[model samples]
Target: MPDFSKLYDDLKRARDEIKLKIHLGSKDAQDEWAELERRWATFENKAELERSAKDVSDAVKILGSELKDAFQRVRKAL
Candidate 1:
């Protein structure tokens, strides 16, 4: 059988990293929003692009979390 414990630990670490990146990205986005507003005084397509990018980033983080949870379950099963 596979080394499920090791797999779980690895997946958990990956999930943590994803979470950290998401947090950092969020802060960066806030800064970006401030800069955009200061420069333009109004919203525009760039904001939409940022939102879309953030959505994709969040989706990846969620997927990573789900994968880690699935791996943990499999580890338990094994």
Candidate 2:
């Protein structure tokens, strides 16, 4: 099974970095956020291929929910 804990950590770190950049009004923060989006997309896509279809679907659902929450925090920080 995919290590969701690790994924969650990565997401958190990305969000933290994004918030820091936004707080500092750095242009590089935009680039960092874009990179985070790309990483998240790639990880989600690969997670879909590493298990049974049902498992993959469930994982995606969980990840999506977690990401939504993370994004909310990011928005608040902005």
Candidate 3:
């Protein structure tokens, strides 16, 4: 089982940084940020960002991947 602590930590940090950058970003980024925030609560709970892959459900792993990609897109937008 792969450890996701680092993956989660990196993305979470990026998420925070992007949040601050949102004010300087466009309306589209803001809208995406809102949606990401909504989804983030659920993602955060399901993904403590420390548990191993075997400890987490496949659904969560998938969500994490999605969030990673979504966050990257948001970063590009900013």
The candidate maximizing TM-score is 3
Candidate 1: worst-modelled 10 consecutive residues by lDDT: 36-45
Candidate 1 residue lDDT tens string, 1-78: 146446645755765565555545777776764574465433334555666787899999999999999999999999
Writing each residue's lDDT as its tens digit, candidate 3 over 1-78 gives: 334667778889999998888999889988999999999888887785535454567778899999999999999999
- Model 1 residue 7 distance off true place after TM-score fit, in angstroms: 44
Consecutive 10-residue window with the lowest summed lDDT within model 3: 48-57
Is 1 or 2 the stronger prediction by TM-score?
Answer: 1
Give the alpha-carbon lDDT of every model. Answer: 0.66, 0.75, 0.82
Off by over 4 Å in 1: 1-43
Query: For candidate 2, which ten residues in a row score worst on lDDT?
Result: 45-54
**Candidate 3 global lDDT:** 0.82
The true-structure Cα RMSD of candidate 2 reads 19.3
Question: What is the TM-score ranking, best to worst?
Answer: 3, 1, 2
